[model samples]
Each structure stands twice: as C-alpha cells, then as structure tokens.
Target: MQIQDLPYPDPGVPDARSGPRFLVWLGRNQLGGQLKALVWGLLHFLSVSALPFCVGFAVQAVVDRSGARLALAGGLLALCGFGIALGDTMLHRAAVTNWITAAARVQQLLARRTALLGSALTRRVAAGEIVAVSTGDVEKIGWFVEAVSRFTAAAVTVVLVCVALVVYQPALGVVVAVGLPVLALSVLPLLPRATRRADFQREKAGRATELASDTVAGLRVLRGIGGEELFLDRYRRASQEVRHAAVRSARMWALIHAIQVFLPGLLLIVVVWQGVHLAREGRITVGEMVTVYSAVMILTYPLRHFTEIAMAYSFSRPSARRAARVLSLERATDGEGSREALVPTGDLYDPATGLLAPEGRLTAVVCGDPDAAGELAERLGGHTAESSELPSALVGGVPLDELPLDFARRAVLVQDKDPVLLSGTLRELLDVPSSGDVSPAEALSAAQCGDVLDALVQGSLDADDPMDARITERGRSLSGGQRQRLALARSLVTAPGVLVLDEPTSAVDSHTEARIADGIRSLRQGRTTVVFTSSPLLLDHADRVVLVHEGEVAAVGVHRELLHSDVRYRAVVTRETDDEAAEQELNQLQELEEIEETA
Candidate 1:
C-alpha cells in the first residue's frame, strides 16, 4: 500500500496534521458559513472605505466654494459613519457566529472521533493531551477560522483606501498607496518570532492542564499513600515550568504589541510629513492634504487587527496541531467477528492468544500482564486493529473490522475494569443511552444491585422515583465493588452475544466475587463470555481457562487443570492470598523453586 494510505504514526509531533490539510478538511465542513461571513465582512469593509474618499470630496467641495461646504461635509461624515456602523455590525455578528459555529463543529467532530476510539484513545494518548485539545485548542482553531474573514476584509479596506487617495490626486495618492504597504508589511518581519512565542505559551498551558487532570484522577490514591504533599510539590514544579513558559511567551507578545503600535505611529508620521511637503510645494491643496492625513490616521484600526489575527494564529497553531492529531486518531479495528446479527450460538476464537470459548460456555482468561488481558478482552469483543490481517481481535467468527461498526459493538461488549459512570439516577446510571425496552428490575436482578438502589433511596435521592435517583458525578459516592457490579449488570442488561469482561470482580470481597461470577455465568447462559482474570473465585466458574503468556496463549484447559498445568497462572492467582502473605517477598523465589520442583 502507498504511504498516504497508512494511518499517521503516534509521533507526538505538534500540529499533528499538516496545516493546509487540516484547513482543507475543516473547509469541507464549514466553507459555506465562512463564505457568508466573508461576504458580510467585505460589505462592512467597503462601508468603511468611504471614509477616505468622503474626506477628499469634502475638502474639494470646500475649496470649490460650492453650497454650504461645512453642512455638506457634516452630512458626508454622517453618511460615512452610518455605512461604517452598518458594516461593522454585520462584520462583527458574522465573524463571531462563524467562529463559534466553527469551533462547535470541530468540537463535535473531535468528540465523535473520541467516541469512535473509545477507551483506546486513553490507551494511545495522554490524558493531558486530550484535555488540552478539547478545552483550549478547539477555541483557538475557531478563532483562526473566524480571523480569516477579518483578515480578508482588512486587505480590501487597505486597497480601497489606497485607490481612493490615488484617484483624488495621483501624486499624493501614489505616496499614500506606497507608504501603506510599507506600514502593513513591517509586521511581517516580526511575525515568526511572535508566532513562536505564542506557541510556547500554548505548550505550557497544555502541560499545566495535563498535570491537573492526572492529579485529579489519582487524588484518592495519592491521599491514601500520604504522597499528596509530594504530588502537590510536583504539580507546583509543573506550574512553575508553565509560569516560566508563559512569561517567556508574554515577553515576545509584549514586543510584538509594542512594535504593532510603534510602527503604525511611525507610518502616520511619514504620511503627515510627506503631505506637508506636497502642500508647501503647491502640488496638492491644503484641504487635500488634511483629508489624506485623516485617512492615513484611520489606517491604524485595520492594521492593528491584521497583526493581532496573525498573533492569535501563532498562539493557536500548536493547539490546532494538537486538535488535528486527536481528530485524526483512528479506532483500531479487529478483522474478525460477524457483521451480521451475531446469534453467537458458536465458539469464540482469539487466535492472538489461542483461546477458544465453546459456544454457550464460560471461559476465563488468566494472564501475567493485566494489560495483555485487557487487550485480549478488547479483541474478543470485535474491536479492530491495523497490526493483524485478522484485525485486532475477532468475535463470533467475523473480523470486527468487517462487521458493520454498530453491529460489532452490539455483538460483543467489553466491560473495562474502570468504567465511566456518568451522573444519573440509580436506574438511569444502570441504563446508559436509554436502555428502553429492558425493565430496571431485570437489570437489578442480573446485577445484584437491589442494595445499591435501596441505599440511594435512604439518601438525598430519598424520594419517589428512587430508580430515577440522582447520582453524584462519576459515581464517586459508590463503592468500588458497587461500581463494578453496576457496570457488569449494565453489560448484562445489554446481553451482547459475546461479553468480554476485564477484572469485573476485582473490587469485591471474595464472597461477593463468587456470587457475581455465578450470576454472570447463569445470566450469560446460551451466550459466549470471556472473563479476563486470575481470581480463583471467578476462575472456578469458567468452563475452560486460557493462560496468556507474553502476548500469546500458552496453555488452555479447565481452571483446575491449569492450576496444576500452568505455574505462571498459579503464581498470579495465588500471589495475593492470605496464606501467601508471609511468603510474599519470597514468592518470586518460591515460584522459581516450584518450577525447579516440577522440572
């Protein structure tokens, strides 16, 4: 396959996608609104153009000694002001709308990509990176998009002003026209450094955001370990780094701003100086000179904005690059799994680990590496990948990639260890995205969540519609086990053809874990289920067990059989037992001893 056809490597590069390409992609989605905004911006710019011409006309009228010159000049000024106001309003409204909508659309598109990648996004991307792109970078991209119209309008305004001056009087106009280019172009020399400074500022901001998210997600654990202060200090250090970066960035911007103001003022001096020379030489009328001076003074408004837009883009470019990388993230697809309604009345095979679950049976996965187990679980659920011809992993004899995405999702569901439980009622939390046809009672029974529901009723949700009871955000109030069972119960309610659960019973007591294992097995009867775990209580319920070793399947049999046959599985499962506590430090040595004994 050609290189362009390949997915982007996880390069950790800034502005992940090329700038021109990203704009083209965005344009396809927003060109219409952008065009409309541009049209309005031009009209507004034209309205302002009347400023220079009217001044010149008023001067000529006064000089010619026609009708009440002052009154006519007042009327012209009012008319030009009215046009300016009308154009300004339209320009402002259109530009702002274009920016907000463009940002929102990009937000929606990025969110969709995140959903498509699901948990995989967190796996491949850092939490800080995602947080930065979604919150800060998105607004910048929108700002840049909106800035396009303003930039165009400013250019047109410059042209109109120059042309008017030249038309009124050629020699005077020539100097003004040529002089304005020099003023506008002066900022160009300083832009690169300014852009670089803005980019540095953005990078610091993203790092700060990343550090904050990490701290929050792990705050509880930090508190437990008494490392809160240590982490706080680390965050302080990170904050300091960001502060330094920000200061450096601000210095560059400060210089740019100073230059922006200073250059235009200098340009004004040049125009005024040349105007006086021409007026004294009798090459241009005094009135003409006054009008020219007035027009040149006004040029600062658009010129200032032009430089600012460039400044905003420079600061925003890094963010856009970050956003592009996220938007471009591809959902790894599994090549296996049936696309059609997975009746799933047959065996589930994972060639990657060589684990096969006979149709209508319970199978347990025992792995040395938790991550490997999780990856296997994802594959078994029919998510796709690029590394394999069979895609990432297969389900029900179909490549997950080949299966229509929705069908694959429904056919096989992977319940992660730490499931995200959005705030909602006990019932609402259990039923995600509207679990309409399924009764809450049935799901509760399947999940063994009656106690959880009862407890919430005793709390602030202590009202009618207890099932519709409000949950604290992220289910923070719920115990770890409750959350796990709730997640499992929800998965059970979905009743996917193949259920791949990663450490579903990890948080519960042994007694509870045992019950959950049985409940899951009974509820999933006549369906395929793969449980990634080495807990003896859960393992005992499996019809068969497969041990994943170094990313591949090493041994397969009944759990009891593997306990005797697989030393690694035994070491992992029993390593946490109370009986093994005394030998915990020596477990590695003990495992080696056991292997030697077996040999």
Candidate 2:
C-alpha cells in the first residue's frame, strides 16, 4: 500500500531480472490487497459457475411437469442470476481499486529514483527513454498487475465448474472438464514465439524514439552544418527498419489470435458430440444433457480469457523489462559521512591532472583536447559532467566521494557551456531553483542581461503577462549568445563556492564574448571560478591559466605568461580570435608548437 513497494529499485539501470519474478515480489509485498481481490474475484467466478447449473435445473423442472416444483426452480434461477450480477460488479470494482493503488506505488518509486539521480538521470539514460518509461511502460505494467486478479478469477471459475459437472453427470461432465482445459492450454504453444517477436519490435521502437529525441535536441547544430538532409535520410532508413520489425511482430500475434479463436471451437464440438451419446443411452436425463451442453458453452468464455491473459502477459513483460532496466542504473557516488566532515570551505583538486583550484581564486584551464578540459571541470564539480566512468575530484581536504551528496552539490556547481533553459519568462528562467530571496533584476544585472531583459518586457510575467515570456524548449527562441548569457546569469545568481564553467562564451562573437569575459571576472570576485575556454578574451580575464596538454596540466601561469611559454596552449586559445593586440603574443606560442612538432 506504501509508495516504497513499487517496481523501480534503481535509478539508472537495464536490469536482467525476469519480469515474472519482479511481479511476484510486488504481490508478496502487497499480500493484503492481493488476497482481498483474489477472494472477490473467486466469488465472482463461482456466481458465474452457478449459471449453467441453473439453466439445467429449469429444463429438468419443465420435463418433470410438476407446476409447483417448476416455479421453485425458476425462482432459484432468478436468484442465482441476481447473485451473479452483484458479485460480478463488486469484484470488478475491488480488482480495479487494487490495480490503481499498485500503479500509484510504482509511480512513486520511479519518482523517488528520479529525484535521487537528479540531472544525472539524463547522463545515464536518454530523455526519450525516461519519457517512455513514465508514460507507456508504467501503464502496461499496471495493466499486467490488474490482469492478475482477473486471470485468477477466470481460473477459479473453470475449476469449480468442472467439479460441479463431474458430480452431476459422470459421462458428460468428464467431457466438459477435459475439453475446457484443452481450449485454455491451446494458446500456450504459440505464446513464446509471439512474445519473442513482440520483444524485438519493442526494442526497435525504443531505439527509434531515442534517435528522434537526439535529432531534435541537436536540430540547431545539424541545421548549422548543412547536414540536415543526411541526418534525415539516415533517420528515414531507421524508420523503415522499425516498420519492418513491427510487421514481423504483428504477424506472430496474428497467428496466436487465429489459434486462440479456432481451438475453443474444436473443444466445444467434441464436448457436445459425446454428451448426445450419454443422453441417448439414458445414462443422463434430458435436463442433465442440457446442463452439460450449457456448461461446455459457458466454459469457452473463461477459456478465451485464459488465452487473452497469456497474450496480455506476454506483451507486458518486455515493457516492464525496459522500464526496469532504465530504473536500475546506479546513482553517482554520494558520501555517507557526516555532513560537516565533507563540507568544503577550501580548494578543489584533481589528482589526475595534478592541478589544485586553490580556494576563492579565479582559475582557468586551457586544453588542446577540449573534451578533457570539459571533463576536468565536471569532476571538480563533484559529479560526472557526462555519463563517463571517470574518477572525481577532491574538494577541500577530502575526496568528493566522501562528502554528503547534498553538501557536495551545494558546494560545487558546474555550469556547462550549453546550459538548458526551461520554458518560462526571462526573469523566471533566470531564477532557476526558484528562491524567494534572490531578485531577477539582480541576477540579470550580474549576468549583464539588462539588454535581454529590456527586449523581454521590463518586468512582464509573460508574453501573456508581459514580464514573463516563455522560452521555447532549451531556449530555442533566444539566440545562442543570449542563451549562454542567461545560463551564466542563472549560475551567478546561485553564487556557489566553486563555479566551473566550460567554454562559457564559445558560441558568441568576439565583442560579446569579450564583454561577457569582462563581466564574469568582476562579478565573481573572491570565488573559486574555473573557465574552460580557448578564447583569448576569456582567458585574459582569469587570474591564472593552467594549460592542459593531453590529459595533464602542461603549464600553469598568467594568460600572458602561458602564451609566451606554452606553444600547444597558444595554438588552441588563439583559434578564431580577433584580439589584434595579442597577435604577436599569440603567434609566438604557435611557432613554439611548430618547432616542437618538427623536433
């Protein structure tokens, strides 16, 4: 009944545990509700089991021709009918209530896992995959949970009906009992192959969804490079492959469908043919023969569900597996030590690079490999920047892994170059994490986004309210420079102890980037700031620059000192810069790289 009992046990996962086993665990945990629904469902089945016997009684009463007895039998039949209707409605309602609560618990588990993982969710799994799990897979798993009760009900109904018929008329009852099972079990032979095909189809569908999501997320970049047509062609080919996979799955299901429909019909024929012989031999009364016939006819209804429940179960398994896998990913390391012990009021250090960002000081990292620089920035933030399995950095005197998660997160904030902007007005977007004390105006002024704010209504809450214009997803409505600036502004507002920025102004023009660089250093005075940029203007603002060569720090000094001394650093930072004054200073470093290469 509690939220903790849901299926999701891990945050980032592709669990290999079979779906059936998982369901058994859930059922065990919620045994009370499961038992309640099971009882009600059985009662419903028994009420239905009374129907065939009632029909036989009415017929036998007519044959006997005793008016009083006939009236009594008819009244009994009516009473049975009322019981059936009432039991059926109540059982259905109880089963449905059980399912809703079961599903709610699962949802709560998934939600809790999401919160535990935070932004790390996207690193471990695709956004589309998460979307699919929460929307489609959750529903299917819930459906499977509810169907368990219905299946149980149908099974009980069949068993009780078989026992009743055997007691009433041995010869005809034997046929009814045996024939019904054959109808129910017939679909079993086809289920595995059908389910295998369905699994393949589901995998392909997930792939297509992930691909579409990736394409949409990077649509702007693709559009910029003139490769939209090429990407579209590849996506079209993938789409066609998915279509073929779907077709194969559908054909298998079709075969299963055909078998389920025809098998019961065969069983019905056999039961009826045998019953006629028993009646002719006077082994059973005419009314008893009618009862046997009615039982056989009604058995098919539950037997049909036996096939259907199997099919639903087969379809639901793959979806549950998909959801479970996504839910099972290991969370990034969070230290369990005392919060105060992990709290950093000092420097950040990376052993891998042999670099230390001394406390409350501006530090810049310039690397020939931009990726290494970005990654270094992320580890220093106390989390993996992306989904790689790299070791993290130490903050103050302790390894980040030894710090309490909430404290580590609060102490270090990583501001990626392409920071996401959710749909909201400029002011609301600026106030990420939505604190009551921080003013939007102060954040904008710090981000140097006054012009952006003016362009948006002075303080309007909307394109609707005039102060808050909703940005399109990822701030698609804003230019790249504007988005970068807004993201910087948002981070500045937080004012965490360590601000790690990777290529903060990579997308902006020289002039805008220069102003941004100028504004950032002044605003972030007396803070431990790491800017991972090759931009000369931005590099100039750093109090000290550490040149990362390959995966290590090649050199460390002021921007001018590194430019004069480190050639590899020069070749990178000088790229696409128009800082006319630093030309001689830049080329000197480039010449050193050429000399080093020749040597």
Candidate 3:
C-alpha cells in the first residue's frame, strides 16, 4: 500500500524468527513504496551523472571554436539541471514516505502484539526494552528500509558511470572502475567493531531507561523509606556507562567516516594525475583531461552512499533484533487450542488449588499470605506466569484457555490489589468496554468514592462537572485512598460476568470499607464475584467465605460460621495467631462468667 493508505488495515503476521528475517519481512511488505523510491532515486542520480558529460562536451565545443556546438551543450546542461531538481525532490518525497510508512507498520504490529499479550508482555520483556523498541528502535528500522532504495540507485549509477567512462576513454576509465570498488570495500573490516559497540550502547541505554522508569514509578515509596538518593546514584552510574559506550561507538563510526573521506580523495588524485600525463603526451586532449578529472570528482559523491548503507545496516540490525525478540513472546494461553464460543454460566473452579466460587454468589477468599493470594487471583482470571503445566481455571465446564482471548477477558475481569488508574479525564478512565448496565456515577457511589468526585470537581477548572477533571499519570496526584477508590469505580463500571477483586478496599478506612462492601453486594447481586481479602468488614458481608491455607482451600462456609468453627480460618481473618485467638476467647468467657454473677 502507498503511504497515504497507511496505518495498514492489518500489519500482517511478522516472521519474527530472527531480527534479520523481521527486517526482510518489513522490506518485502513495503516493496511497492521501495520501488517507487528506487525509480525516483535513479532519475535523480542519473541526472547528476549527466552533468559531467555536459561539461565535458562544452569544453570540447570551446576548444573546437564552434558556437553551434557550444549552444547545444549549454541547452543540454540546463535541461539536465532541471531534471536533477525535479528528480531530487520527488526522490526525497518517496524516500520519506517509505520511512514513515514502514515505521507506522512496525508500530501497528507492536501495538497488536502488546494487545494480545497485555500485562504479560511486560512480565516477559523489560518495560525499558519495550519502550526502546517502540520509540528509538522503530526509527532505526525505518532508516534502513528507506536507505535501501537510495543505495540501490547509487550503486547502479556508479556502475553506469564507470561503463560510460570506459567506452569514452578506456585508459583512465579502467583505473577508476577498479578503484571505486576498492574504496567501497575499505570500510568492511571496521564494520563489525562498530556494530558491536553500537549493540553495547543500546543495551546500556535500555538498562538506564528501565532503571529510571522503576525509580519514578516508586518515587513516592522511596521517599517515605528515604532511599531515593540510592536509586538516583545507581541511575547516575548507569547513565555514565551509557555515555561511555556511546562514545566508543561514535569513535568507530568516526574512523570509518575518515576512511570514507581519505580514500575518495586518494582516488581523485590518482585519476587527475593520470589525466594530466595523458594530456601532456597528446594521448588525450586538454578538454578530455578536464572531463576525466571532473568525472572522478562526481563519482566520489555516489561512493559516499556505500558507507551510509553500511552505517544504516549496523544501527538497524540490533534494533530489529530487539523488536523481534519482543514480538516473539507468546501469551500463556496462546496454544493450539480451539477458540470455540463457550457460554460458561456455572461455577469458576481452579483445580490446581481446588478452589471453587459458585455462580450467582459473592465469594470471599481469605488468604493470609499476600503472594499466594495474588497468584490465586491471577489463576481465577485465566492468568499465570508463562508456564502451561497447570490446568487453566474453568468457567462452567469449559477451560478459559480454550476460549478466545477477547471472550475470556469479557467473561472475567480481575482488579489486583494494586489497581492502577491511568492518566485521563475521569470520564475517559471510566469509559472502558463494559456491559453498559452500570452508570459511572452509580459505580462511583458503590465504590464509596463520592469524596474523590468532589475533590476532582473542586480542583478542576470545570467545577460543575467532575467527569471533566483530569488525573495525573497513575493518579499520582491523588491520595492512595482516592486512587484506589477511583480504580474500584472503574472496575465496577465494567460489570463483567465474573469480577475478581484482590483487596479492593485495603487502602480505605474501616467505615469506608464497610460501605464499599455493602455497595459491592448490592451492585453485584445475582452475579458471581470473588474477592480475595482478609478484612472482617468485607468478609462479614460475603454470601460465602473460602479459606485458603498453604496454597489449598482449607475451609468454606458462611463468614461467622468459619470464624467460630475453624481456628485457622479465624486466625487468618483476624490477623492473629492461634494462641492469641484462644487467649482472647478465654477473656470473653471470663467476662461472661462475671456478668452472670453480677446479674
């Protein structure tokens, strides 16, 4: 497709077996644009090559004392100049279009891969590396794609010029023809060194980017713990390492450039020296000598493209490889499983943990170990680390892994303990793909975040509408409770078939938590909801409570029933040891005995 038809309706499946293969795939996909650029480039370079011949003819005409020949030569010269201008302009336009379109296509492909993988992408690949691939590496890949056409035109024009000179004047032509290839091959030995240095620099830069990202993401926590300075120092060292690697890379490229300049100058001297000797010996005339000298000078111009192509390949190779590495990652569920439509309206079960949450009920999971709870929550939502050894969580009788990714996502929505709120208008943040049954305002009230709505409306210039208020990235500007409550509202608005919430009200106070728990029961009535929490406030409101101990379901019953009947369950939910629980139980018994005596 042409550049105007860009943002390809589909970026197509990439052959990400290797970086070089990926780059080749990109070039093949954009062959139409590349050919367009090549055609324009040929016109431009051919016009330029013709200028030396026109000057040679003009000199010959002056020597012959023929005004007619002079006029003809001048006319041809002007016509060639106009062709050069037109060709150069169009060539640039075509090349740039190729560049932008290739970059856009790669970007679209990356976006699609990211969508398919979701948070798993970052888990498998570094956030920094992904960022580098999408931002800097994308441009490098485009540069190589665009350079191919121009390099082709330059090489073809160089060959044509060498042949024309051989036909017109073989004695000096043979020398140039042989020397041109030598000049082009001179930088081959240094290319590997340059490429290695560039790779190292890219790696260091990626690490520095990752470090900076992590530091910023945890800046608030770091300050509270007084460790920001330590991270800053570490980042400074990373930046220095990046700088040193860059300088080394630049040195190698600089040396290659120096050879590019020095070798061409040497070739020009040899051609001019031989031409002068021929002129003095009467083997060739004065005009012929000038023509040969000017031709060599013009030949140096196209020869420079040889080094440019080398540099482009060197830079883009590593970038394409990194992009390929990222695209090669597959989601945990991306297997050869049937994507048949499955309308699962029964209980959600995790066979690995033997945990079951019945349909049309609010089930509260009490896990004292936060990490285990998090892992269980992920399983309940059909998410786990890349391993596929364990059977996937099932909805009804169908495995979530067998269902299509989009359908599974719609079927179960999981809000982790730390739910993130992205930067946007309040309205935009809540406008997720949802069932459309729950309004944003109703969700907000259900989340007990009415105060958050008030704060946004008052802080915003558009005071009349809280929905218009903008949130900073990760809702960093708001308090922890505000961000948590806002994220809860957004999740409630989704109104999924099964909602898995992990400590959804951990950041809020007891009173607020109680209201949120009641709201959740009211809003999610007659729907399956699994909440992983130890808070008595939320567990007290659950239709049924399941206790998980040591990665297995230990007990399941009503909240009060489990609290009184199972000592382990009571210890977990109450955040106490069995000894402490018994001591408290004994104190209660003694108080009852004294009350009976007083009565």
**By the TM-score metric, which is better: model 2 or model 3?**
3
Worst 10 residues of 1 by lDDT: 1-10
lDDT (Cα) of model 1: 0.73
Please provide TM-scores, in order, for all candidate models, with all chains considered together.
0.87, 0.87, 0.95
lDDT tens digits by residue: candidate 3, 73-134: 99999998998899899999999998999999999999999988776677688777888899
lDDT tens digits, residue span 1-599, model 2: 53345453542222337666655555565567667677777766676667777778878888887677778777877877777777778777766766676566566667877766666677778887877777766777777777777788889889888888898888877877777777677667778887888778777777777778888888888999988898788789888888998898789878777876787677667766776777788778888888877777776666666766776677778767766665565556754544455457688888888887788788888887766776677678776543556677877777776677767777788887668888766657665553234355555665667566555564344364434666667877667877888888888777777889888877778887787777777777887888888878888888888888878878889899877565566667766344643676667678989999999
Worst 10 residues of 3 by lDDT: 334-343
Prediction 1 TM-score vs. true: 0.87
True-vs-predicted CA distance for residue 197, candidate 2, Å:
1.1
Query: Model 1, residue 527: displacement in angstroms?
Result: 1.8
For each candidate, the alpha-carbon lDDT, in order, equals 0.73, 0.73, 0.88
Compare the candidates by lDDT and give the number of the best one: 3
The candidate that wins on TM-score is 3
